[model samples]
Target: MPQSYVKRILNARIYDLAVETPLEDMPLISDRTKNNVIIKREDLQPVFSFKVRGAYNCLLQLTDEQRKGGVIAASAGNHAQGLALSAKHLGVNATIVMPRTTPMIKVEAVKRRGAKVVLHGDTYDEASEHAHSLVEEKGMTYIPPYDHPDVIAGQGTVAMELLRQHSGPIDAVFIPVGGGGLCAGMAAYIKYVRPEVKVYAVEPEDAACLKLAMDRKRRAVLPQVGIFADGVAVAQIGKETYRVLKDTIDGVITCSADEMCAAIKDIFEDTRSIAEPAGALSLAGLKKYVAENGVEGQTLVTINSGANTNFDRLRYISEQTEIGEQREAIFAVTIPEEPGSYKKFCSLLGKRSITEFNYRYADNRDAHIFVGMQILPGGNDRQEIVEKLQKHGYDVVDMTDNDIAKLHIRHMVGGHAPQVENEIVYRFEFPERPGALLQFLTKLAGRWNISMFHYRNHGSAYGRVLVGMQVPSKERKQLEALLSELNYGYSDETDNPAYQYFLS
Candidate 1:
């Protein structure tokens, strides 16, 4: 089956729109990881993503009648821009149905490419349904984001260029997976041409649809998926893509959000290019593989998939990079609330630099301090610091891996509100769109009295809000029902240790 795709990939008519992206060496990452590391510069494509290759190739196969009828697709961002640009080049009309939560920049980009942009529902599924309806009504062909043979063959061109560009031996290739189109295509080509070179698929930890599918030995849909790497936040691997990838891919690696952020920084340092979280996903997996296996002196390659990230998200990415790189450790330590206690604590820390120190008076007997310090890149250093503090008779709780602590508590470390009773804390992520906050407040505020609230914009597809509301025990079920009706992703955090230490 893999052999069957070789000719189609070689003959894919994408050169008119898609350039042959270069394979560039990452000198800094190569030296740091002790491997000859290189990256496929797919991010440098005209559409700033490799999606154009498949979009154009698929369009080239369309019959003259299909071209006259045009094409329709539902995409969060990249795919829409790709199809729009491709259609413009071929003189075919395109209709793109995008989620309302899609960033303005992408919507405008599609419009500028002469595509009719339809702002549909909050999620891709909703927009996709609307797109299908339009396809029937307008008698247009439906262009799936990543499920067709033509598209897969088109994406395989990346591998064709990669192997041709680098004739030297390559140990492995890392490709990021969303609906698995790029991974499936690339893996098929690589396995067919060079069976010894392993192909690994990379996915976000919270959006590991391909990994789950591989484990289950069948395609499975995720109930929900995290959208931090919005480009690859697909809840299900495509039917056709899963078919090819299940056989061709050597393994799957999933990385956390923090790890992806660190990879973004890594790409920036090596190439001076800012990659979107999904764009840097393969590099994150490559780093994890090298560290976990203690691998060295091998040639590794990964693709920089895209570079269409919103500028505002860089702040959040920068904040998490230190922790992602294991260069920062955060903890909650209790000390006596008396004179010279701070000095004593500092003395114990010795020469280590403190990244953050937040404390507020709670009682005379003991005081809880939220502290952050620089640490070496390994698990051992963080553990040593924790053990040292505990050995000094100080109660220490590691907050470095705590989501609430890093995202909210670090910015809201104030004394506990003793007077607030029956308070329940919940973290919620809702579609980030106009009047979304107002709608959320209108539905949630009337029944329960708000005790605490914190909201920050990371400029992704969703808005995260932490809310503490006072609901009596008897009315807890009512609150749950209301939350279910609200239809937002939420998690109760009342028992979170970060909140227990600083803001309960």
Candidate 2:
């Protein structure tokens, strides 16, 4: 399998549309990790992604009859742009089906490339179903985003370029996995040519299809997947790509969304270029591997997959980077409600940088202050700070890893209303469409009294919402049924420690 892919990759003919991206050194990353860190600059491609290489190669393999009939594909963003540009260059008509939740930046980009853009469901899977139906109805060729052999072979060209560009002794190469195309392609080529160099597949923790498939020893589907790193939010590994990857790849590494955000910041600081979450995934995994294995003086490489992120998303990414890198810690501290208590707590904190501090009076006995403080990297300082506060008689609860706290409680720190009885808190993922919030509110308006509501746009495909409703115990099941009927992802946060400490 590996040997066969090496030949196909060498002959891929993608240079007509895709440039040979550079293998550049990251001096800052290298110094920090004690490894010779390097990045494959695929973000510099014509489509600002490595997808163009595969998309164009797939098109080149199509028959003249097929090209005349045109092509169609379903993609969240990157692949849509790649195929659109490739088809435009080949003078072929292209039709792209994208999720309605896709960012406007990406939708406009596809239209700008002369492709017919159709906004369908709120997920890639639904968009894909619609694209396949169009392909059947119009008798057009359906260019898969990743599953096909030609696509895999074309993606393998990245490894071909990487090895040729840098002839050094590389310890490992990390590739981000969505439907496993890039990982399978690169792993096959690398193992065939340089078997000694390790190939690791990286995926977002919430959408680790490859890791789940490896564990099951077969293709497995996730019931749900997080779309924070929307570019790689695949629920299942592609069949063909998985076949090659299962035998060729060394291992799989999964990373959190925060870690990916941190990697985005790292790429920006080192290369002065903002990488999309999926683009920075491999770097996030590389950093995790370095920290876990404690390997020093070794050569490591990661692919910066693409830079097609919306500029507005950077604000949300920036907010999470500090926590992702373990440079900041959040806590709910109980201090005295009496005068001079706030001053005493500040004296205990000394000169540490305070990232955020929110407080509201609840009672005369004690005060719970939501605080965020800068901490040294490596994750130990956060616990050390907690112990110091505890030793000083400050009852502290670490909210650094609390999802509710990070997502909502931090913003609603002073929203304590004890008088409001039967208040149940829920966190929901609201689609980013214009009427989504209003629709959500309308569904529950007459049935229940809304006690609290909070929402913040993270500039992704969805918005995070925290809602509190007044419902009697008798109507609890009815409320649950209504939420189910609403068909939006949500979680009960009524008893969540962060909400209990701050809002309840």
Candidate 3:
């Protein structure tokens, strides 16, 4: 065994963890990124996290007298459950103080593991303060989430496992940061054993307490944390953990909610495991850091710390995956107003699947249309579509993979303008492909303009389109003739009630 392995043996007796987690090389994800990426599946640990290793190790180190006195802990979720289970195994009384805003599932989980639960305050800081007061008032042992030498030693066991199970030297290790327990422990241990390996800490951009602290060269506190990634939504890093992290960790990076979601999906596709946003932070960090630094061909290991994620959040994850990866595109297009103009426009999208479609032809102004579509997975032909639309003088605003488009524009703004007149509505089935829409736009002729349109690709074989056109009623015959030539399905909603409100 190596020195790192020997250290684990000396310290193994201190932890109460029932099982050691495995480090498995993820071939699917490795191939996707064109690098050797291995995952330390801490999510599969007995506690569904490496938290048990530290929580139990800290408790076991206490003298018999301290055990008799009992113990207290503060956490938003995972640590609470870890301590609760550990105290139960040790036959010691444990009380967990959680913020009142903690999710019901987490609160129940802590209690289910046989710990007395006390809900206090709205944030973790307030709850931690209350826990401290209890410790002083009742003389109970306080088991902190991190910020202790013993905790760091115990959490370091994760690195112990990685070195033992992995065959190759790790180029980089990405770890998620909260109170900085995991990063601090892993960094200290890795540096002590393998001085050449690099350690990186990742945090949610909205709640990047560690990143902020590293930049300021002091402990920094955030006023609010985004609860989306609940596990790592900590406002401040622990003092002792920060001491180890400030110098031991090579760098700190922040990831956006969207990027994290995409990472989660990618990991799920590869490992068939659902990682919480916090758990996905390490993978997201690796992607961002690698891209920024142009790192390539490096063996990487990212800790999948915990997966205690809510299932409801998966819906949003699925919906935004394309948007997160920039595979979906949204556009605003303008066409000449005329009766058959809508059909001619649909011909432009050759094979792109439409995810959403809406149109209004009641009111009129300049023919401005909004459209959204999910391009085929891994498709990168956006410029080709733009060129086709530009050739026919169709002005388009591309919003694919744009945060502003997904969060705001995709569902907002469409239909006929009340200020304009002679608008008509038509819905068409267009092929969902990169240049399909552009070709239709190129073939369209005349002075008639497009008033409103909505189209989004859903990664399907066919596309559904909604378009509003402004043109003379006499041009209706010509538009029908063009539709007949296109040989695709069509629906005319020129008189629909929705057309009236949006167009009027």
Candidate 4:
């Protein structure tokens, strides 16, 4: 049976370490959706996340002996800082085992809070495992990021503030879910007090553990999770949070990394504050909910859960925002190899603004043109543009949502591998470490020649590389063996359309 969670929230000893964050009305999103949209600005917390509340609440329950023993925990980013700050406030030592996938800025922030930082494996689960091992070795208290009663109650304080801040009718409350502590606490309180108000839990599509749990009627573990929204990229929902979610939350929604990036842009445009991907997750889900359910003029509220964004990530986020919002589209068009063909193709687009155009001339009868166009509101749909080009006797392929087109192809428009045979293009992501690239190259052992290589560091947790290896058919099995031994996350992209069209 559920305890009196609202009472527990009211009594959670956390006010000394956490502030009552504001509930700001979002005029831009509200005006766009024609609804009263408000954001619970938990991002304004001293720790830049609502996590401090739960972290402090959990630590407050520690015995004097336990506090003296210190605490151990694992986190991707936000929870680490929250717990670190809480431990500092209570004069307790904190050891945070964090995933290497966490951004450098976040790692530095956690250390700045006076926590002993342990950079472990690539995922939160791996970090958690290391933390648990420390618990047994050091006899320190293990502070879970979520799944505990105290933590849940502490997170419930968010809903308490929400209900008190706005007594008016609210159609729904959208919350971002990772381990689900925030959703569990808030949903339980909201359901107990204002039963009419619906609660929605939002997650990234690449890591929708709550949605999977709801569908299966039990806790579900994801085989893999997206790293973009690292704040909420949990492989499995916490058992305690799943229990509360099943009983109290009305629905679960999922959005893509691109959509979250778009939400980040939306928040920045309105509030002049940049939110991390997980912080903007609730707003992304809200947009999807409105578009799918045809919701209009209803009061919807979502929490800006955290603002612990890495400044360098803003470039990639900005690049993806327009595509996420459907305000920009890209295409590859085929036209005749004649002098007037370019002029004719331009005429077909009418007055639509062309954002990009890339063409590499080859001695062929037909030529391909990679084009990017601005998509105005209330303008012609992408398909309409394609159809118009088709009517003009030009073949077109839409590449707006093609990740290869977005990530690599557009950057290097065309580079034909003339005589390179058996060229296998592979994309790999490896942990950023000194001599990492050299180590990978050494592991290959000169079995194959590298025909092409491309790498750009935009300050991500991992280094991304696009490599074209000239491996013969007879050596394919050998190459696979080497890759398995080297053990880097990779994908074979030899047959990718972007590769075939732009770089073949």
Clashing pairs in 2: none
Q: Find the number of clashing residue pairs for candidate 2.
A: 0
Following a full C-alpha superposition, what root-mean-square deviation does model 3 have from the true structure?
14.2
Comparing 3 and 4 on TM-score, the stronger one: 4
- lDDT tens string, model 2, 335-406? 999999988998888999999999998999999999999999995898899999999999999988887888
Question: Estimated TM-score per prediction?
Answer: 0.99, 0.98, 0.75, 0.96
Candidate 4 lDDT at 14 equals 91
| Model 2 stretches astray by more than 4 angstroms | none
Q: Against the hidden true structure, what lDDT does model 2 obtain?
A: 0.92
lDDT of 3 by residue, 121-235 (tens): 7567788999999999999999998777667667888887787787567899999998888788788778877879999999998899998898899998896666667778788
In model 2, state the lDDT of residue 297: 99
Write down the lDDT that model 4 would get: 0.87
The C-alpha local distance difference test score for the whole of candidate 1 amounts to: 0.93
What TM-score would you give candidate 2 relative to the actual structure?
Answer: 0.98
Q: Which runs of model 3 end up more than 4 angstroms from their true locations?
A: 1-18, 332-346, 360-362, 366-370, 375-504
Which residue pairs in candidate 4 collide? none
Go through the candidates in order and give the C-alpha RMSD of each one to the true structure: 1.0, 1.0, 14.2, 1.7
CA lDDT of 468 in candidate 3? 71
**Superposing every Cα of model 1 onto the true structure, what RMSD results?**
1.0
